[model samples]
Target chain A: MKIPTLHIPDGFISAPVSLLFLVISGFFVFLALRGAKKQLDEKVAPLAGLAAVFIFAMQMINFPVAAGTSGHLIGGALAAILIGPWAGVLAVTVVLIVQALVFADGGLTAIGLNVFIMSVLATLGAWYLFRFFQKIFPKNRIGFLTATAIASYLSVPISALGFTFQFALGGTAAITLDKVLIAMVGVHSVIGIGEAIITVLTISAVLSVRKDLVFGASKLKVSLVR
Target chain B: MSTKRIVQIGLVLSLFVAAFVSFYASANPDGLEFVAEQVGFLDTAKDSATGSSPLADYGLTGFEDERLSVGIAGIIGVLLTAVISFGLFTLIKKR
Candidate 1:
C-alpha cells in the first residue's frame, strides 16, 4: 500500500502537460498573493512566515504505516485554518517549489501540476470542506476533530482525482483513466486517514497553544465545545 | 516566546536538518517510482540533463550504497531549498 506521492518525475509527463501545470501554478501563486494581501498586515507577515516554515518542517517527519507504506503531513488544511486559504496555498506552493528547484525532490517541469494538485487543490479544497463540515458537526472537540478528519481525508483523493485526470489526459504513459483513478483513489484513501490524524492532532496542538491561531478551531472558542 | 519567533527558528533548524539528511536517503524507489515500475512507464521517465553536477541519481559516480547517498542528497536538498527560499523571500519581499 503506497501513498499517493506528490512528487511526479520528469519524462513521465509531456512538455505540454508539464507546461500547463507550470502556468496553472504561476496563476495560483498570483491568486494566493492577492488572497494573502488582504491579511498581509505588518503583523501577519511574521506569522505567515512562521506558518510556511512550520509546513516545511512538518513535511519532513513522514510516518510509516502497514509495512512499506508511509504518509507525511500535507498541512494544507492546518495552514488554511490558521492563515487564510490563499496564503496557505501560497505557503504550500512555495514549499513545493523549493522542494523541486532547490531540493530536487519533485521535478521542475511538473512544478505547476504539483502545486496545483497538492497545494492549491489540497489547501483550498480542505478549507472549504472544513467550513462546510463545521456547520453540521456537534461544535465540540469531537466535532472539530471529526470535521478535520473528514475534510483532510476527502481533500487528498480529490486532489488525486485532479492528478488522475491530468495524468490520464497528458500522461506520457499508456495507462487508462479508469485504472489510474482506481489505484490513485484507493491508496490515497488509506493515506488520507493518516493525513486526517495528523491534521487533527496538529490542529489540536495549535489550538491548545494559541487557540486564536487554528482557523478551523474557531468553534472551539466557546470554552468547551466538544 | 512568541509563536512567530518560535516558528521561524524551528523552521530554519528543521530545514537545515532536512537538507543535510537528504544526502543519506534510502536508495529504495519512492512511492512514485515504485508505482511507475508496476504500471509500466518507469522506463519512459526522462532526465532533462539540466546540470553537470556530480551525484546525479543520488549517486556520486555510481556508488554502491545508493540509499545512503540518496539520503545525503535529500539532506543537501533541504539545505539548498531553505537557503534559496529564505534568500528569495528576503530579497524580493524585503521582510
Candidate 2:
C-alpha cells in the first residue's frame, strides 16, 4: 500500500498554474514576513516557534474521516487563535517549507500551492472570521471558544475551496470544475468538524492554564456594563 | 503561567505527539487524495523530486521497524521546525 502524502503533489497542477501560485505565494510571504516582524515581540516570538512545532507534529496524526479517507490538522485556525494572525502565517509557512524541503512531505514544485492555501488563505481567513464573530458574541471564554469553533470549522472548507479554484485553473485531469469543487468541499466540510473540535480543545487547554498566552482569548473580557 | 513554562509544555506536547501518538495515525488517504481519486485526478500526481530522501513519506530509510521509522522522523521534524522557526522569529523580532 502506498503511503499518503499531506500536500498537493506535483503534476496535479499545470506548470502555468503552479508558477502563478508561486508568484502569489511569494507576494504573501513578503507581506507575512513584514507583518510578523512588526507583531512579534521577544516574549511572543518563542511561542510562535512552538506553535509551528506543534502544528508540524499534529499534522502527522491523521484521524480517520469518512470511509477510506482520513484528515489531519491544517492548523491555521489553531495557530491564529494561539498566536496573532501574522505570526500564525509565519508559523504555518515554516512548517510547509520544512515539510517540503526536509521531509519531502509536500511536492517541491507544488510548495507554493500548499503554502498559499494552507498558510496564507487559511490563516488569514480564520483570523478575520474569528474576529468578525468575536464582535457579535459576548466578551467571555464561552464566546471566544464559540467563535473559534465556527472559524476553525469553516477554515478547512475555505482552504478546500482554494484548492478547487486552483484545480479549476490548472488541473491536469479531465475532470469538470463543478464536480471537483463539490467533492472537495463536501469531504472537507466533514473534516472541518474534526478541525474545529481539535482547535477548540487545544485553545481551551491553553486558556485553562495561561489565558494571556492565547491571542484570541486575551482580548475577551467579562462585560462590566451589563 | 510563565512564558518559559508555557514553552516547555508546548515542547513536551509536540515531542509526545510526534514521537509516540503519531504511530496510531490512520493509514487512509486524506481528504484531498480521496477527492482526487473520486474525481479521477489521482493519476495526475507525479513522484516528488525529493521522493528518494531518507525521510520521504515520513519514514527513516532502511529502518526495519515502521513505528521507529515514523516516530523518529516525526521527532526530527518537530525539532527541526522548532529550531528554524524559533531562529527566524527571534531574528525578525523587534529590538
Candidate 3:
C-alpha cells in the first residue's frame, strides 16, 4: 500500500492556491540549498548524488503492502539519514519536480502541494522524530531501525494532515475534512509499514558499508561535521 | 566509493528495479481508485482532457500481448525516470 500521494484532484485547486504552494515549496528549496552549503564537506556531495540516484531507481520498484495496495519508497528517512534534514527535503523535492514535469505521474498545478506535503513536511518531520527516537533506543542497528520505523510511520499522516488542510482550505470536492482526513490517515497507516521496513533495511545496509555517509546514523568522529 | 563500484551498484539496482516492477506490482486498484469507486466518482477518471498522449494507463491499451505492452511501458518509465533524474542532478550540481 503506497502511502497515497497527496495529489490533489485536478480542478480541485485554484490558480492562486496552486501558486501560493509553489512559492512556498520554492522558498524551501532555496533554504535547503543554503543549509547544504553550510553543512557540505567534500564527502557528503558525491554521496548525496549517489543517494539521490539510488532513491530514484528504487521508487520505480514498489512493493505490495496488501492485496491491492502497493507502497513505494518515499525515501525521506533514507535521505535524512544520509544528508541533513534541509538537504533531505531538497533532494525529495527535486525528484518530485522531475516526476511532475517529465513523467506526468503527478499533476502540474497540484505539484506544489505534492512536494510540500510529501517532501518538505515528511522529511523534516521525520528527521525531528528520528532524532528523538535515536536518543532513547540503543546506539546500534536497533536504534537506527526503531527510529526509522517510528519516523516513517509518523511521516505519512503528518503529510496526510498537510494534504487534508489544503483540501479543507481549497478543495473542490464536496467531501468533508473529517472524511478526507480519516481516509488519508487510515490508508496511510497501512502503507507506512512498507516504508518503515524499507527505511530500516536501507539505513542498516548503508551504515554497515559507510557509516561516515549516513548523517543520521548515531555516533561518529568529532571533525566529520564540517 | 570507486567510479567502477558506483557503476556496478547502479547496474545491479536498476536490474533489481526492472525485475520487481515487471513482476511484483499489485494488479488491484490503488487507494485512489478504491476511494473513487466507493464515492461513485470512478467514472470521472476516463480519458484526460489533453487526451492525445501515446502512453496512458501504463500502456495496458487492450494490446494482444498483455505482458509485452506492459513490460515495454514499465521499462520505458524506468528509463525516462533515470534520464530525467540524472539530467536534473547534473544541471543542479553544475550551478
Any residue pairs clashing in model 3, and if so which? A1-A65, A1-A69, A2-A70, A2-A71
TM-scores vs. true structure, each candidate: 0.80, 0.96, 0.81
Write one digit per residue (lDDT tens) for candidate 3, span B32-68. Answer: 4454445444443333332233434444345556555
What's the distance in Å from true for residue A128, model 3?
Answer: 1.0
Q: Per-residue CA lDDT of candidate 1, range B1-95, in tens?
A: 46666566656665654444433333334334545665677787665343234534333444456445544554554455455544433333323
RMSD of each: 4.3, 1.9, 4.3
Best by lDDT: 2
Interface CA RMSD of each prediction in angstroms:
5.0, 1.4, 4.7
Backbone N/Cα/C clashes per model: 27, 0, 4
Q: Which of 1 and 3 is ahead in TM-score?
A: 3
| Model 2 per-residue lDDT at A102 | 81
C-alpha lDDT of all candidate models, in order:
0.64, 0.88, 0.63
lDDT of 2 by residue, A16-103 (tens): 8999999999898899889878877777778888999999999998999978899999999999888888889889999998888888
Which one wins on DockQ? 2
